[model samples]
Target: MGCSHLVIQRDFAAFFLHFFYQSWMLYPENESTIVSWIWIGIGILFLTTAFIILLVTHYFEQIRKNKRKMIQLVRNAETECWESIHYLQERDRERLSEELHDNIISQLNIIRLNINTRNGKELNSDLKRSMQLVRELSHNLTPPDLNGIELSDFISDYLVQISKEVEVLYVNHTEQDILISGTIKLNLFRIVQELITNILKHAFATEITVLLRVSVKYLSLVVKDNGRGFPMEKYNKGIGMKNIQSRSRKINAVYKFKTKPEKGTRCIVFLTLNNTKI
Candidate 1:
């Protein structure tokens, strides 16, 4: 904007200089009255000022149009992300249905048979497994804590649910538990979930580390994996990353990713905590 303004001023300066020269040439040196020259000068000045104002206004309008265009692009991207999120929700429902029928129902039926046969040990074993399955399903539906307190513990619990397949470690560095709004907590949870899902699905890494830090003024989350990192330009444009981007913006957070092929990846999220409940 500044460059455009400067160029306009420079061009206008030259154009006005030539215009005044031509106007001066219109009158002979002695024949031109002082009042007439003054009038001519005032007219030139007025036109120059008006043209500058017009240029400034035009530049401002262009800026507004660009801003609107950018907002529309974001809206379109977010709309696409919601479609992906909905697809994920549908898949979760299908998986839950299958687990209920194939695992819990079948296990319960076996326990019933064992009880009928007076098999106490077998019945106890089946009951334990059934309880575990139910707990897992419950966790999948809702996070461990709904109040948005104890975010580290919530993340720890989530990791537990997925740790059996791969090694996962979590560390909390905050001196006190952080109380965040439900909106922040839920978005962070989804972001964390998406990062881990990507690692598990594609990274093939056996070690995952999550670090949580909350201070009086700000909070940060770090998720790192020792898996094969992806190309920044290629893989970072996926719906998962775009979803994270939108969520980051919604919460006024900064989301950054550092990665390289075979070098592993680290994701960082930082946000101010001024609005957070103590």
Candidate 2:
């Protein structure tokens, strides 16, 4: 490398001297002064060209760096905003859970006891059904036990419970020991929840399926529904879909979807456990 650089410098110097000699020879009568001005002009042009190139390169680099930073900043802001929203939702759910457990459940029990004593069996049965609905609502807000639980198991149980409302089928090809960081797990779980919620809200289908598969390099989850699907271009570009995409991107996961009207909607989420740039 040193020898190559030395040779480059030598060649440049020889070219410079040759160019100067020729320019001076063209104006040999007053060659010295004219040659000086020509050399100065040549030098200025070289410096100006160098400066322009450097400015352009610097501007391009700055633009690239600013674009990257802006993207990162927007993503971070999105994450924080979602977190705050989740926190608020959880807070509201917690409050609702407490009200259900404390006020509504207690009042329903009292009503049940009062009716059991005063009214016939029909009234008591009605009270029991109302109490049951309250209990279901409470459970839906906050999971009973999640501490030290594997997310796969938690999700499995969740789907089974959801299956009671609408059919849910789980196809598992995962090795079962693929544990992830808590934050990653949380984000993924929320994504699953969001997809499931979307299906419940929109898909008037009889059955939905969630598939999990994992390999040494990647973990993938596929959620599909046998519903009256929407136009692929329409729904996939909707707000909910965009939100899912954003959350998936935060975890460096690849998100894809396939859908056909009157057919079904299928979403594939793939994540790498290691911090490998996508």
Candidate 3:
């Protein structure tokens, strides 16, 4: 009986040990599955973070590229402006030479001939005309006084003088007084003179309209004619057009030209007054 009891007790102890071993193996399998899921979650989070960083970096790169392009464009425009100014100066020198040779020198030669021929009667008249011509030319070259006179008054006087030949209509659309720098005023005067001269020389227009608009922020000048317009492609190649462009750049103003065949020509110059010398 004692031996049988001892064997039964040993069997029961073995059965308990086997059950505990099986439980330990089952627990390890379940823990391994949980660990694998946690590892996958960590990998997905890392990938998502990397993607967001890449997107942000790409956006900033695009912004930097655009900024560089804008800076380059501004530099190019400034260089072109300086080149235009140089060309204009050269053209003016040529004009001065021509004026001296054709007008002043020619007139002096005639006077010398008259004196050599002993034509005293006509000499006085010729001398007076030549002096008057010289005075007129000098006045046109010199800059006008803007201290006492307003810009509108100066332009009005100019228009009155030119009104005799062509029907000119002047319109000033500003309630308050307009003020501008002497340099700006002079350039503006020259631009207007050039435009009118161009119209007289080329445009067979019956009437011309000059409009001046002023505001707190900007000033605009519009010159339009009712005549046959020339081709824009050809006209842009002319010296007069180049002169206009150079003057506009000198003033740091915006220039626009509108024209079509038989539709007449319109030139508009816009100047911003904010933080500008004008």
Name the lDDT value of residue 277 in candidate 3: 32
Q: In model 2, where do residues sit more than 4 Å from their true spots?
A: 1-147, 275-278
The deviation in Å at residue 68 for candidate 2 is 29
TM-scores for every predicted model: 0.49, 0.46, 0.51
lDDT of 1 at 227: 93
Model 2's alpha-carbon lDDT is: 0.68
Worst-scoring 10-residue span by lDDT in model 1: 98-107
What is the TM-score of candidate 2? Answer: 0.46
Q: After the best TM-score superposition of candidate 2, give how far the Cα of residue 201 lies from its true spot, in angstroms.
A: 1.4
Candidate 3 lDDT over residue span 123-224, tens digit each:
787688678757856765443357776677777876764565578999998547556767666567667766776666577787989999877678899999
Clashing pairs in 1: none
Using lDDT as the measure, name the better of candidate 1 and candidate 3: 1
Model 2: per-residue Cα lDDT over 1-278, one tens digit each: 33454565567666777877786778678877776867786786677556656766787899999999999999999999999999999878644644444334433543433452445665566566666657766566443334466668757865754564577889877555555556566556667766776676677777899998865568899999998887767776765565566567768899888877778789999987753322
Ranking by lDDT: 1, 3, 2
After superposition, the stretches of candidate 3 with alpha carbons farther than 4 Å from their true spots are 1-142, 275-278
- For each candidate, how many residue pairs have backbone atoms clashing (under 3 Å)? 0, 0, 0
